[model samples]
Target: MTVKTRIYLVRHGETAWNAGGKFQGHSDIPLSERGRKQAKALAERLSNLKIDAFYSSDLSRARETAGILAEPHRGTVYYLPELREINFGRWEGLTFKEIAEAYGELSTRWWASPLTIQIPAGESLQQVVDRCTRAVAGIITRHAGETVVVAAHGGVIRVIVGAALGLDLNHFWQLRLDNVSLTVLEYHGPEKAILELFNDTCHLHEK
Candidate 1:
């Protein structure tokens, strides 16, 4: 009576804004040329696995990345808005320096205490954690004892990983989610999960 679920958590490939370190939260940015190649490489690496389902954030970059990976399996890709990146509000397209200059002390506070601070028209870390938790819970429930792949943004990945590991949102920075990197998590039923891998880029290195 042991149910095991294998989940492949992936961060979408690089985007134009990602290279520039600009905030792309909720932005429907497309993948860059290199990004597309990275996705293809990942697809090839994962093609042999028995992936039962594919899921991705509704954003274009994430969907495109997932599409490339799911092609070999002919897997059905589901888009969940809850998997989208946290909204950056007025800092949507700005870099850290730009945000610092514009909001000064408030920007510092936001970075230091994002769990409690809310950006203008943006979401708090807690809000993201809640949404991502619900989304992940639903996916795990629907695909119990199966293998699935999820392509999403870096922020979303962090929140999801943190929740799975029982880490605080403020400690999310400890997890590195490079573009096109693969992370694996195993769910052994409710409240039981294990991190098998994180930020794996072996496929990229092979290129």
Candidate 2:
């Protein structure tokens, strides 16, 4: 019998850029007012669970969300810069429409072939996956057999989910992670992993 490591993957609460449909890669943007409420609701929902440890992106949005979630669990949040969102370069703070209008084919090609095209002055998708994987690998190895919570950005979470499932990077973009949503990954050993839940936002609907 192999000991399992259950991971509660959480996307951070909404930020202004998220609401505005802007690319927030590595911007250190803080969450909006409603974002706090969303985090609180999720916190209340997970408060009863036996979350053994908490890890989060060092960005303010993810850090703050993880802090709220970790409050009732009585765990210190270990910040990981490697878990930060992909660097979008000049695309930061700009909407996709804006980027398209400005950069035209470059932006369009990026949306169509993200893995092949590199963003001007920014890190590539592969770079994002590399560092995020490094962070998650360390987290999983250190906390095996424990239920751990990882609060991070959507891009970061998507990278993790893609890596876990051995899915192609291009197809990984199809995964939609809403604000404060929870996805779970259960690892039965070094070779077997299962996605028990994905993008669950029921906790956000609490009265």
Which candidate leads in TM-score? 1
Q: How accurate is candidate 2 locally (lDDT)?
A: 0.90
Q: What is candidate 1's lDDT per residue for 40-59, written digit by digit as tens?
A: 99999999999999999999
How does each model score on lDDT?
0.91, 0.90
Candidate 2 wrong stretches, greater than 4 Å: none
Candidate 2 structure quality by residue, lDDT tens digits, 47-166? 989989999999999999999999997889999999998899999999988998999988878877776689998887888888987887787789889999999989888888888889
TM-score of 1: 0.97
State TM-scores per candidate: 0.97, 0.96
Clashes of each: 0, 0
Off-target runs (Cα >4 Å) in candidate 1 are none
